[model samples]
Target chain A: MYQLIDPILVAVLLLNFAALGASQLRTVIHAIALQGVLLGVLVVVAHNEFTIWAVLMACAAITLKGIFIPRLLFHAIREVSIRREVEPIIGFIASLLLGGLGTALAVLFSNTLPIAQEHVGSLIVPAALSTTLTGFLILTTRVKAITQVVGYLVLENGIFIFGMLLVEAMPFLVEIGVLLDLFVAIFVMGIIINRISREFSTVSTRNLSSLKE
Target chain B: MLISQIIVHVVLLLVMPPLLLGVIGKTKALFGGRVGPPLFQAFFDLIKLFQKGSVISSTTTWVFRAGPVVGLATAILAGLFIPFGGHASPVSFSGDLILFAYLFALGRFFTASAALDTGSAFEGMGAAREVTFSCLAEPALFFGFLVLAKLSGSLSLTAMLDGPMPNSWGAAGASLVLVAASLFIVLLVENSRIPFDDPNTHLELTMIHEVMVLDHSGPALGMILYGAAMKLFVMCALLLRIVAPFDSGNIWVDWGIFAVGMLALAMVIGVVESIMARFKLTFVPTFLVAACLLSAFGIILLLR
Candidate 1:
């Protein structure tokens, strides 16, 4: 499990960059889905003991986060009838350079923390921090509402990775709450996108500024 | 024995490059599900090129003729610094990595300038694109050198490359992985391979490197082709030295490993070309910048 954890974390890091630099909306969504699936696997592997609940929880997380959310995002895009372009407030290169800088800072910051015995050598801390920073960068920098939602998914994935440290301490109810919040967010956003496409004939969040304060 | 080593190095650098191009062609052909050109087709093309007459333009000056000659000279010159397989480079000194790197730039400068000297807007367009992209790519290559410098605690290409012995791989494996990925992207962009610029594109408007050489013919063109092939080999050698740093403690065995590693690198390049579409021209800088950041991250990993 330890051997596998580092590689999985590295894959997550790479996916974070892939999402950051991607020019198309579908590529970002795909990177997010693959990342969600990897985190699902991490949930099982992070546990010290193989409980039946962990396996069941992993499957449920994988199904919802990996399959259900991406499918919803794809459906929203299809309904919106917009092109696959990723219109970023910050250019792709700028965002990518910032993401790299953030990853470096995250790694450096994690190095200074006084971690406990079991988690001392694990990469979860920096990977979690970097993944979160990348998600936030995307969320703030991308103009499209759908891409912003994709950023939200990545942000949650980072928080999920960080949760591995307190796997035993964190209650099952808390995980359920986070997942429930995500589901509601996406479900409502999907409807909103559909509604926006119907009313304005477009889904660019920039257009919403037309409504006065 | 030193003289013999130098002789072997010279012979290998001069002779083995065309075969790698052949392997790449063969691999791409296999991907396209067709019987490709023979493995020695690059050599055959070179011979056929040299046998023909060159139609030098009256409008063009001597710089036009000097381009291929300078390009080939700089490429093979830089090839002397890379430690192939387990063997030390024949010509290496402190700070030679910098020289090795700028040798590439020097080669590009001459090639692009020569393209401009042709007074053709077409070649000038290609030259502009080539020089502009190198501006992005140069930093990535330098960042990679920084990672190597940090890892090996050496400045010369020979020592910087040799530092990644099997033991160092364990200590700095993560950083090395980042460097390798970055270097691979640089190789593709620098060599004009597909996914950055396709070497085989027939359309002048689409291809950056090929378009620049369109005005040259016969022996001058052969030098450019041979130079391009050698450039590919030299870049692959630098990459393979880092990623596949294997040694058996025998000179003969290490040389054999090198031959096999170059073949593998060419095939891997072919696979990448086949699977990935050429990035949009606008997106090329984005990838190059990503390459820079990747290696920068690699260097950051060493801070701990």
Candidate 2:
């Protein structure tokens, strides 16, 4: 079971590195979408239960995170017609180094935490923490609003990985509500991205400094 | 049995490095969609270089002469301390890891000083870059050594390497993986490969290691090339031991596995060179720093 699940988790981690190093906005979006899909699959593999609740949660996660969010972000990028993330606050290589450091910290930090009995020896928590740190890295370093949205999605994917640990404890309705909230949040952010592009004629958040006054 | 193993070790140390270089060349050529040179190309080049006359600059001192000689000598000496495929090193003692590392450092110190001895601006620049990047690489190497030390509870290179048999992987796989990765990066950087420095480029301003040897000719240049291959072989052997970590307990099978692993590693390095362009000069430090963080992380993972 672990042999199967660990590779997927590793792929997700590599996707984090790819997203962090990618200079193209489209690549970043695609990497985040792949990570989301991997997380959805992880939910199924991690649970090993195959109950109705687990199946539904995985489907919802796949739909909202993998399909819905990426499509929305891609549409936003197309509307803005921005192809690359130029002049990021932190350079791509530096951000990648920071992402690696974050992953190490996450691994070390996870060791100190009190993991549930069933998830012992599993990489769930460290993967989740590292993914979240990578997302935070992308969020702060990238200037494109669309890239920031992708970062936000990656951060949520990390949270969702952690949330899988509570599948047995948390109520089913709560999970659905959380997915619904994510959908709405991205919807609202999409609208804001469109507005920012229209107002500034470029999707770069660097231009948004005018509104600081 | 021990004498035979030592003979095999000496033969491999002498004959294997040039082949690895040829493998990398052929792999790169294949990637570029051209017919590559024969696997014996480096061997032929070494022979050709050894037969040529020297070209010493009037301004150069004895330091220029000593560079390649010391470099080759230190690389060969360093090989004595590294075990191959679960075989004990020819020379091993407590605290040998420190000797193993400093031997490379001693070679670099001489090489850089020789480059400076040329009094050429380009060689000076190359020497400066070599020293600067090595500062970052050395730390990563030490941290990797630290993890190995912790893993085997030994300061000796042979013990540290042979101690981590197949069974230890079950216990500290994650930490080992991190260390192997860091060591691979160090290998790439230390050898002046692509994503760090391109060895094949003709542009003098862009060259690092090649530029340092621009003034060297004949046997001296051949010695430098041979020394580089030896360094690459030693580092690749170190990484291969960690990554493969398989021992069948038959000496012949073990040697065969080690040879195949080293060749495959060369091919991997070739693929990396073909796929990735060198990083911008300013960003090279970032890459080395990342390597350091990786080994440091390995240490952290081991402690946890």
Candidate 3:
């Protein structure tokens, strides 16, 4: 179970960094979808004993996160004329550097804690947390609204990895509830992205500053 | 043992958040010139809202109703891990802080989603600002906790604070000021208070959390407002936990200090509210960024 969880978690973290480094909106979206699928696989493999209900929930979560949300966002991108993510607040190299720093920080911090070494492997929590922070950094640094949403998804993936630790402890009802909320959140954010594109004539969040006093 | 702990945890979990709100409200009022309404004002408000039926906007969907309940449930569940007075939390284990933080994000996500669901431009604007500031604020918060864990050499909040790690008043003071300041910004922003926002304001342009719930009424509205207040109190309690040097043995004295600290913090917020005007919207992020910088400073101080 630990082995199954570790590789995917690391891969997702790397993919999140890759998304941050990408200049194309389409590439970022694809990377996020890839992460969603990886997380879906993780949910299935990480648990000690997987029930049919767990499998179904994992599949549903994957379907929504991995497939449906990306498709909807792609459609929203098509509606908007802006296709490229030019002039990210941080350059690609800087972002990669920051992602590296974030990862190192996670590892360094996690090592000092009393968590048993054998439980989830050494890298899982720190890597996930670092990836989460990196995603957050990208979200704030990027000017494009779509990139921000991608950043949010990356952050969500990071949280999901951490959530794996307490699979036995947390009620499945709460898990499903959280998943449902994320689905609706992304669905609604996709709608808002479309509206923002139509209203502002660009997907850049910079334009939204017009309302400021 | 397990069953009793679970029961106790569940009961305390359910009861503490609302009472925290009551304490803050009463404290803020006392700080102002007048004697406030009863501390149970929130409970009274909840009851009144239950009796009154809602007036739903024709434009609104089921999303509006679902949003508040989702936010409240997420909050209550998240509260399970936060150690109030010094007992191991109900769901204590490694990486619990991550869940605690993310659960709050779950609340914000729903709140933002419901705001957008209304299709009102005002609500959308408020949601946008909320996300923007929180983006800066959340990392600062997590980093502060990371430093606290380092200082105490414990993973969970209950352990990190109550464990026998040597507490440096300087490091603790810096970190506490940093975290408390960041959380104070969060308290004002999350609760839609003055400076970040004016809770009393009806104009959509000036709204943060308020406009999001413009369409919700009755029990739903009550839950959202009460939940918002509870969130403020939760953050305050966390702040108090950082500042007040209460060991695991002296739980009663710790609870007393916690209560007193809660009032002091609320009074400080009220005073700040009375003195400050709402910052210009663009400038609000700058204020939050300042808090984030202070948190970073706190972390660096701990490292040194």
User: Of the candidates shown, which would achieve the greatest TM-score relative to the real structure?
Assistant: 1
Candidate 1 on B71-131: residue-level lDDT in tens?
A: 9999999999888876788999999988998998999999998999999999999999999
Model 2: per-residue Cα lDDT over B128-230, one tens digit each: 9998989989999999999989988899999999956576688777778878888998999899999889988855587778888888999999999999999
User: For model 1, how many clashes?
Assistant: 0
In model 2 chain B, which range of ten residues has the least summed lDDT? B295-304
| Per-prediction TM-score to the true structure, in the order listed | 0.95, 0.90, 0.55
RMSD of 2: 2.8
Which candidate order results from sorting by lDDT in descending order?
Answer: 1, 2, 3
CAPRI-style quality class for the chain A–B interface of candidate 1: medium
Query: Tens-digit lDDT track for model 3 on B91-173?
Result: 77777888888888889999989999889878888888888878877877787787777777777877865554325454455
Interface RMSD, candidates in the order listed = 1.5, 3.4, 12.1
Point out the higher-scoring one by lDDT: 1 or 3: 1
Q: Quote model 1's iRMS.
A: 1.5
DockQ of 3: 0.02
The 10 consecutive residues of candidate 1 chain B with the worst lDDT sum are B159-168
Give the winner by TM-score: 1 or 3. Answer: 1
Q: Looking at model 3 chain B, which ten-residue stretch has the lowest summed lDDT? A: B163-172
**Which of the two candidates, 2 or 3, achieves a greater TM-score against the reference?**
2
lDDT of 3 at B94: 76
Model 3 steric clash pairs:
none
Q: What DockQ does every candidate get?
A: 0.66, 0.37, 0.02
Cα lDDT tens digits, model 3, A1-213, are 655565566567657656866677888889889888888888778665588866876897789789988997788778785676888888765676577667667766876767754553345678677778977988899998887888887887788777877766777788788888888888778888888878878888888877757
| Candidate 2 local lDDT, A8-70, one digit each (tens) | 776788788878877778888888888878878887786777888878888988888888888
